[model samples]
Target: MSRKRLLPALALLAFVAGCGANAAADDSAKLSLDAPLPTAVPDGAKIVVGDPATEVALKLSGQYDKVSKYVQFANLSGGPQTTEAFRAHALDLGSVAEIPPIHATWTGLHVKIVASKFRQDPLNHPIYKLGVAPGVSVKTFGDLRGKKIAYSPGQAQGALILKVLKKAGLTKDDVKLVELPSTGDVYAQALAGKQVDVAPIGGVQIKRYLAKYGKDGASTIDHGLRDDAGHLYGPVESLEDPAKAAAIRAYVAAWGVAQEWIDKHPKEWIEGYYVKNQGLSAADGQWLVDNAGHPDIPADWSDAIQRQQETIELLAQETGNKVIEAKDLYDLRFQTVAADAIKGGAK
Candidate 1:
């Protein structure tokens, strides 16, 4: 919730769940920034939004101010807050993990994915480890049949847990889902306090726990549960307006710049955000710099959208049968713009 903050105070947990942008004329041009605005453009960019982990890059690069001149961005907390913003039509441009947009679509919210990228790297997969309580014996998803899980409904972790359940031939009814406060170190605290059987954690939380408890004290279950993508979205109403639409396009292009910047300057990013902002150690910062690759803002959705649709469908199985197709959720107008801005392609 704090502006430009990386992960929360709890190091390891924040590392796992920390949320994450910018602009230029040539970059904006790729997104049709030069398009003539409608005579009656909106007065201000008063949309509530999320942090999305890009605030640092956008600020450091000085692109945030350039884009904000046209599009007013109001920052919210993270995934849970952004989900509510979408539900209430309180946000124009927002960022969230995969599940929020799917929920919006099912609720008939006119939101579309403007940009997206897979969160995992094949070589350096994110450390979303499933750590069980000291006394519990949940070694795999199948072992979660009667266990209590730390879950935040409609968030990325919940969606992931559902996928693991499905793969293990288990259902939601087979386990006990516990809701934990998203603020601070709730996930780590819950696990340490023996409140939940299995807690999916990362970064500082994992480091601290493993150091104090050791592998024998706190067991981890690695089910190869990785590969999730984050999305930047906006309401259709704003996208239909000429002025806001231009701003949105410009933002998309600037966003690509910010994403590239993070990947290119991982060391600066770690120091500025992970170490300085999130209170992580030099070692923790270096780990993130080495592992958390820059996000991929896909220029083409043919393959990515299909993967997203499949992910949504898998989660929907737990939320009832209201189906949401890829066509209903994505606005691909900016794909070319993203392609123009990103140098190495959207991988």
Candidate 2:
């Protein structure tokens, strides 16, 4: 019954090392350091993590050194819960969708996006579908008018739905919005169970639903709705602390190492996490490998930061809210430090 416990499995990092950014090794010889750089994650530093992917990377790569001892691995359901945990000071570093930090800023929560992942392929993108229950008559965005649509404010579904509506020349006033918890697969389940006429559901959940229900059961809108990027964010208080900030830099660097490792060992990742932990069939796991690629650490934040700003501005406009500047939402210091770490680690 809790809002935070929605899709418990999503936090499992089923497709962990297989989405966004590919790190490749050159033919150059590997460098061996006699001693780790001082910027390496400090010994036994406490950090909180809500993302299973980040947790997997940090642990599997053994990149964070002894800092894992201080980590509290929280199985937060989604961005909304992760944002709440960040606001409550429950976690030092967390990952959430693009909208949560904007909402956090609006609500006076001090948070900043430190790292991000982006995918260029449409299928690779975490595309959310506008689906209707089996018996429902809705087909396109136009049919959504006057219909009861699932709504989870401040989450990706809610934000993306607004964008879809704008493209269709419709607004919330044109549709009956049914508010729901912003965590988990409940929204997808709602549409599948016919509890709502139309809802935003992730592609993976839809794939699973079709695997269970027939292809005709849960119908998806063919509209080209997609999200290309997700963010790893942290509390501003922690980011500003000299020690914690340094630790975060090291964490992002270590993450790059982990991502590089996954890129080279796709089979191990699919067999280990997807098939073993998530129970996906080998074929399905391979499907993920082919679609959801490995994430890369952004070497620079200028362009990505601008894109995040544009997204926030669009969301604000679609929801009839005042526009917010990207400058207010992000801190780019980690980008520089992470670049240094990734370079040093790669060498």
Candidate 3:
């Protein structure tokens, strides 16, 4: 071969090798959970969130426009639907209790919690109370020993039932666990029809259950456990994307601000969220407001993580599932993002 021809061929090979190295680098560029989160949402970055309550809160609080540029809210919530959405890659964020993330991990879906909220006075404003079926005599947790308690294994309500049983010193063998879906008014309906002797019910269900079945001796009693665990979580893949991560950080900040707005302006929240959006009566809305206490967003998630660890242990024991470290379920890089945003009034 001629020297000139050989030199050009060698140069072309060198250029191809360089291009291959750059492509490899790009392919390996995964986000580190320990690294600091990105600070800006790149142009055209978008996140699909399945958190209807937050969507309404943001709009009513007038903070929707601030995040609407990069955020799209979907009418989705709860563990099952959110997990399904995550599996289909249709949802970037979801609002759920502490259970969904744990269950998702068990089912082989990697996820992380970006924001956490609890009731200010969690005991006084417990998320659910034990609804006793008509003609069932369950005045205390001890009474639950022989009663058929409604249970939903993957949801928060199911975990709460387990916590209650542990508190009562009763094992699953001691009580009849009627596995039921706790969506909508199923628990309430179970109580009304006497299908289950006891089930955990929250919000307006507590008031309506008694009003309709008081004559038949239906009642609700405080379970005396702290069950107010609210969180915004997302798939690890979504959080690893630089643009989506930045957008999530911003949405979390806006979410924290919207929580504060709802706490401060109960009337408007009741009207906009409960009465108008949820199709509940004004009295029902007011009742929810009266019962909701206040929002407590913590800058530090150590205590929350520890509590989650305990829950994981309990669930593992009951369901015979592998126990996981709660810390791994959280992305500590976002530990203080929402709290700082609320304090700084960013939205």
For all predicted structures, in order, the TM-scores are 0.79, 0.79, 0.92
For model 2, residues 158-216, the per-residue Cα lDDT tens digits are 88777778778898899888898744578777877777888877746766755665466
Candidate 1 global CA lDDT score: 0.65
Residue 166 displacement in candidate 1 (angstroms)? 1.1
List ranges where model 1 is wrong by over 4 Å: 1-49, 87-89, 120-124, 344-347
Clash count of each predicted structure: 11, 7, 0
The sequence of per-residue lDDT tens digits that candidate 3 reaches over residues 126-225 is 9899999888888878888789999999999999999999999999999999999987789999989889999999989888888889889999999998
| Candidate 2 overall lDDT versus native | 0.65
- Please tell me which model should have the higher TM-score, number 2 or number 3: 3
Better of 2 and 3 by lDDT: 3
Candidate 3 regions with alpha-carbon error over 4 angstroms: 1-27
lDDT of each: 0.65, 0.65, 0.86
Candidate 1 lDDT over residue span 137-256, tens digit each: 776567888989888766777777777787799887898889875456677778878899887776567667667656556777765755557678876665655555666666667777
